[model samples]
Target: MAKKLSRRLQELQQKVEDRTYQPLDALSLLKETATAKFPESAEAHIRLGIDPKYTDQQLRTTVVLPKGTGQIVRVAVIARGEKVNEATNAGADLVGSEELINEIQNGRMDFDRLIATPDVMPQVARLGKLLGPRGLMPSPKGGTVTFDVAQAISEFKAGKLEFRADRTGIVHVMFGRASFSPEDLLVNLKALQETIDRNRPSGAKGRYWRTIYVSATMGPSIQVDVNGLRDTKLAA
Candidate 1:
């Protein structure tokens, strides 16, 4: 069923134009259209021209936004011995070895991000059934699995995010909150665009970036002009 729109939402929707907007203009308009009582997140939906069936065409990576994500990221680390202390001192929300694993196995998952050291990966492997579908399984590419637990914890807690293309070859990431300044949102959005452009798959053919759109959490999406940043090398 379609949701019932509020008067504020109806009014906000009327201001959006039907044409593609520049990155800066889209961010500015998205903030203006935000009608939610709470601070809504500003997200970007990027469509790519790649086939997910091929392993080489898949894209999965992380980027640390210049302005941190307004939401606090609760991080959990799985390590042993000194590495546990390293994660704890680095401000990890939860740190453990076997006990933490057991807690998760018992259907207790309190943290948003989970990191595991290489040595304890063998033990962490048991939680795959519970974590894999939730995208919480530690992976080296996403920087969620590493020997340097401290660095991983600190980076993740400081707004480092993992983004990967879905089955339809689209990458969705929240750049920042709607309450952020237009310049800040643009900086984060451009950083994400650059990261995706830099990590363009080798098998991708012409027109890598198919479409780009930006919107507030509960507002209408505004199409972004992919060609608008051609001079800055954001051409697709």
Candidate 2:
């Protein structure tokens, strides 16, 4: 049996026409449809032409949203000696070494982002089973594994997002909150588009970009004009 849509969701869906819209117009519609009681997140769903099953075709990287993620990002760090203090001084919400690993093993996931120093990764690797599925594992490519723990914590707290293409060749990311202005959301979306293009896999074939869509967390998806988004240039 198909799950029934909420009355609010049904009404919101009706407002979205079946047509691709310009980036700004799509974002505006996204805002208009975000009528949830709580502040909903603004998200982007992009389909790319690549197969991650092949090593060379994989796409995994991070983008810094200029307007920020519009939520408090709790950061946890697993480090040793000096790096632990560095993480703390940099405003890490939680900091520890072995004890931290043990806590996560016992199912304490209080933080949104986790960072670890390079030297501690071997030990941190033990928690992969617990963290990988939840996207909490510290990865060098994701900029969560570094000796400069302070900088890593600072960047993540300031809206640095790690994203990758799923098995279906689509990238889903939350760029900001629905409470943010459409212009602010557009800035973040543009950054995401540029980042995806910049990190295009060497093995990806023709027509790398398939489609792009944006929506509020509880709202209907709005298709975005791929060509229009690509042609957009923001002022320096």
Q: Which candidate should be chosen as best, given lDDT against the real structure?
A: 2
lDDT of each: 0.89, 0.94
Per-residue alpha-carbon lDDT of candidate 1 for residues 92-210, written as tens digits (9 for 90 to 100): 99999999999999998899999999999999999999998898999999999898888888888778899899999999899899999988887788778888888888899988989
Tell me how far the alpha carbon of residue 197 in candidate 2 is from the true structure, in angstroms, after superposition: 0.2
lDDT of 2: 0.94
Worst 10-residue lDDT window for candidate 1 reads 227-236
Structural similarity to truth (TM-score) of each candidate: 0.94, 0.98
Model 1 score (lDDT) = 0.89
Clashing pairs in 1: none
Task: Judge candidate 2 at residue 105 and give its lDDT.
Answer: 89
